[model samples]
Target: MQGEDDLRGLAKIMGFMRAVSIILVIMHLYWFCYGFFAQRQWTLELINKILQNFNKTAGLFSHSLYSKLFAVLLLGLSCLGTKGVKNEKISWKKILIISSIGTVLFFFNSFLLKFPASGATSFYILSTGAGYILLMQAGVWISRLLTTNLMTDVFNNENESFQQETRLLYNEYSVNLPTKFYYHGNWHKGWINVVNPFRATIVLGTPGSGKSYAVVNNYIRQHIEKGFSMYIYDFKFDDLSTIAYNHLLKHSHSYRVKPKFYVINFDDPRRSHRCNPLNPEFMTDISDAYEAAYTIMLNLNRSWIQKQGDFFVESPIILLAAII
Candidate 1:
């Protein structure tokens, strides 16, 4: 991880390098096209002028050549190398090798044009050298940035609360379920690992603090919209049950499927369905029986503060587990 400043700095440097590479590529391409199609007579005139001024006759100046075409191809390769370096798709050493070869070829072309001794040629040579130097500098800085470690800057371990909050973001989830979590006054989408078979959500808040409302408004609405099956436990109040029932009704009307809703209230003797923890249907297998016995013992004790239970308390659980 890197700090925002470091990341932004690296990006800006890469941008500058990319710009330089593109400019070099375009300049070479323009020169190549001009030399190939339009600049034959001008090249002849320039060569004649150079020969006359230098007081020398050279066979090399007798004909127009496609030297700029080679420059164009080399510069194009350099541009691609710079782009790859910026994207981290090419190794720095490889880019350096490619750019160095391009630079050598560029300098060779410049050398071929240097004997003409014109103001335009001098400026072109200076600018090309400066551009290539900047490109190399950018590459070096980018490599440094990639190699440097900024883990401490990005993660402030001294801030325990911040670490705790960020830890939830990296949790492995079976499904990335979106939760329109309300944080810092605005509603933003977050994700939870509740879809995992071993994972579940536990929302806790004091009474009248919108705990039920948050679940009903955000999560319940999402489940209904996505046509997902949901099981809600509303212990004290029927808030969640009512919200689920309404959503189910709306969904049924829209999809034309009459979904069933089961309610089991242990507090209401008249309306509550009979639920037996010791039913034979629950103990058909050893795993089921073990689970049933554990659940029964948990419900009876309600707390595990004392791990080593006294004989009076442990004897019944052991007896019930053995019998099951």
Candidate 2:
């Protein structure tokens, strides 16, 4: 797992380097052209002339043609690089970091060293590096500004009730909530209420599509690290349950207040524990009796409730409620 993570990280870094290199290479080539020929004022006149003199005055090799071609190449590269980054898997954070590093390095090379610009390779290198860094930083800032503007518009367009609810939730939870959320190829914070603040979350996918691994690696991992008690129902091979048990054991050993771990596999009736969900001890009072019944009913009739509506499942729920 560690090796896999390392490889993933390396791949992301390599992608970042590829993106940075594209920008750098284009910038360097543009700088080389400018230094070699754009300095000549005759190049501008030749472009404006539209070859009226025909092949009389050095034709395309003249400074005018060379500079114009270079300019077009520079513009083309800029567009290509921008489009490439948009389609690539590179992250903004990596781009920003690399740009910042390049900017710093070029700043030192240009100002501290006081390098002479006599068409030396080092001079072009420093100049182009600085230019690329500045351009990329501007691009990053513009993208961020646009993203912020879009977010603001979305917030403004949202319903007042939704806004209020969001604010209320934010105010209600001041501390960071741990969650095992995956979004845009990144693992993000998922809200798992440790204090029985139940919120329904469902993960669905075809078999062998990493549904179990995602749950165990992300959600279960967070639960263990945060010391949250869990009632895991592992029906297939119990791989996730085993991983959770190992983590729980380690956590229990580390903490002063040892947490409990249980495996209530009903398949192996002899090995199964004697904890009953229907046990009255699990309920607080008559009010909780309905909830306990509803929980057990939902667990037992998952397929029925899923195929039929909750209204269809209401009868059994009410019956179990009264019986409990």
Candidate 3:
């Protein structure tokens, strides 16, 4: 309410200011062309005397062109409070472009009017002045045209809205994540497709966010169905292994070569497939023995992988390699 009242008050003041500006412009025009009028005896002596008195008293403002410029300046300032309307065509750039043309024409003709023998001086002055006035009014009209957008929060977030992918892409290794999302009005089905399983995939979610049940299990089942030979490091050994084993068992015919499932569980010896790292058949040199030692030690204590160059870590690994 207060803002609206303020705008109304400003508009009224601006209207008054514009009226004063127009009156000043008219006065300047009359004063400057007074000699032209007097030559034809169009103005009375009494009125001429009053104008002369005004010219003398105005001091620094005596110059007709300067006074007119000041009035034009005031008119521009008054345009600030003009109520604006919504207009699509007339932009600020266009307003400036046409106004600039008018400004040049008005000043050029104004300068030409000063020459005593200048031809068409009256016509030029009238034409340029009218053109300037029309351009200035166009600017005010633009102000009115722009006011319809005075809304506080009329933002369009629609530009950021986009079409979600509903079609699933397929390949030999692409793992599809079933996705359900609401966009616009309807629920759309999509896939968070991972094309290359070799690339590191980081799955992040809060506990109970279905990281295991929804996404992981689907990946295991899909890969098995596609006949991929995958080695899964199940943190919960049985949880993922069971899913992979069952899914693979159901889709065994898909693989061209028969694939075997293996489990290495230290917690329960009966549940694990026991194997010798330094089997005589595979070990041909000391390097094989060293590698077997490195793998065994790293698997026993994973931290040893990063501590390979350390003296204590290297000493134990070398000792194990010698024994093997």
Clashes, model 3:
5
Task: Please give the CA lDDT of all the candidate structures.
Answer: 0.52, 0.52, 0.74
**lDDT-based ranking:** 3, 2, 1
Kindly list the per-residue Cα lDDT of model 3 for residues 181-225, writing each as its tens digit: 654435677878788877978889998898999888988899899
The residue-level lDDT of candidate 1 at 178 comes to: 44
Candidate 2 clashing pairs?
43-64, 179-190
Clash count of each predicted structure: 0, 2, 5
Q: Candidate 3 lDDT (Cα, whole model)? A: 0.74
Report lDDT (Cα) of residue 116, candidate 3: 69
Considering lDDT, which of the candidate structures 2 and 3 is the better prediction for this target?
A: 3
**If scored against the real structure, what TM-score would every candidate get?**
0.37, 0.34, 0.48
Return the lDDT, model 1, position 250: 72
What are the RMSD figures for all models against the true structure? 16.6, 19.3, 17.6
Best candidate per lDDT, number? 3
Worst 10 residues of 3 by lDDT: 152-161
Given candidate 3, what's the lDDT at residue 18?
Answer: 88
